[model samples]
Target: MTDEELAISVSGLRKSYRDNQAVAGVDLAVRRGEVFALLGPNGAGKTTTVEILEGFRQRDGGDVSVLGVDPAKAGADWRKRIGIVLQGTGEFDELKVGEVVRHFARFYPNASDPAEVIERVGLSDKANSRTHTLSGGQKRRLDVALGIVNRPELLFLDEPTTGFDPAARREFWDLIRQLSHQGTTILLTTHYLDEAEALADRVGVINRGAMVAVSTPAELGGRHQATARVGWREDGQARFEQTDHPTDAVRRLSERFGGEVPELTVTRPTLEDIYLEMLGEKEEQQ
Candidate 1:
């Protein structure tokens, strides 16, 4: 598929289970070779939306397309071109790390080498170790290796780095970067705002089973030109003011200090701050 074609498309998507409406009138579009993030609180219908896109669940109403075909009608060839790393853990208690990877590799007609995939996820040293013996982070890496073993055109990562430590998280980000560089479209869902900022080309924020906004990380919540807080120590107490022109504020503070402002800091809204504000706004509207 060319870059212009949408890897995922949905319009007025809706899903309901019994009396509960899980997803409601959602619209989304994801471009090829882009890392798109879907973020929302628990029970916000994020899982249901993903499951529908993955063809694991049927939507109650609305149009949906994945790779130019309706997910519900897409066949095995369509399934082979997509990879999914679910939130649930894999069961390979009796198999060695390499053994499990190799086992899965055989299922795909064009799979990545098991050894290479293991190395890519930083599990070369644990290739011979039993899968059950690996740490939480290591096991997550194994899951990732299995997901990408087919070298799919599109990948769905659901809370991919849930149990990772700081170091492991960074390593996992590198792997994601590598996949993106290879022109693999990715759809990621995670609660980590920083992760979304670091990886997603575009992010869509969902709340109460509806998409609230969609934009690049910098543009989300009006963060690109949002007011910045400028602060400095004055009379042994810290004072701060929010302003759109932080440079001018700093210049004025510099004059007040005759040179340098004491403990001066110009802080812009971080991804987390902006995300929280967006969520708050959504709540108020509801």
Candidate 2:
């Protein structure tokens, strides 16, 4: 995409703490209105890379640009254009939900209505509730409310759904979709592979401070091109085989059985499968 079409761009990003090389020669680019997911295991430098992009931490070397300005040189105005929802809850336990949201809105030049943003995050019922009284999931919703109160052009979400139940997670997924639909650029970092699969337009995987792969959920780790596993039960025994053409295999099995193949299943590799395979390969290399 063109320069005007990009929200974030980085080249050869490097960072270190003493002898610990957290990020090494990383390159990343995010479009103006896309939900990009960064997936990696613990200590894979994902947090370091994101912190550098968010201007919270400085890098050791290489170029970095966010919203057309170097994050290292970004000022208050630059910050107003970006939103951040960290992995932990905000320290506003003494304040009511609405109070917290309204307080943050004052920091931005053109902030959204605190009440509207609170309702947008499904927190209207808790508007008068103290921040400390909220359940874990409710606190997370408050975090999201604060993140979008500025109506930012770009949002950074680091494990935003960590404390949610399955139903709450699904609801948060819908909220994320709504934001992406409204032309907000989102950079997400999450440990849940399924969350990335459900929400991201594109995903980049990092390992040991290096980028391993970047692709759509369906095609990552060559998953789309990988062989399908066909399985069936025959004569009181279970059997399965990997084949390029699952349909052909199933058809032949149907004919052999002279009818529907009993307990037949044709399945492709799942995202978790592909992810583990990639990690295993990386470990072998080390």
lDDT of each: 0.92, 0.93
Model 2 agreement with the true structure over 173-235: per-residue lDDT tens digits = 999999999999999999999999999999999999988998999999999999999999988
Error of 1 at 9 (Å): 0.8
**How many residue pairs clash in each candidate at the backbone level?**
0, 0
Where does model 2 exceed 4 Å of error?
none
Q: What 10-residue stretch in candidate 1 is worst by lDDT?
A: 1-10
lDDT of 1 at 26: 94
- CA lDDT of 243 in candidate 1? 98
Clash pairs, candidate 2, are: none
Query: For each candidate, what TM-score against the reference?
Result: 0.97, 0.98
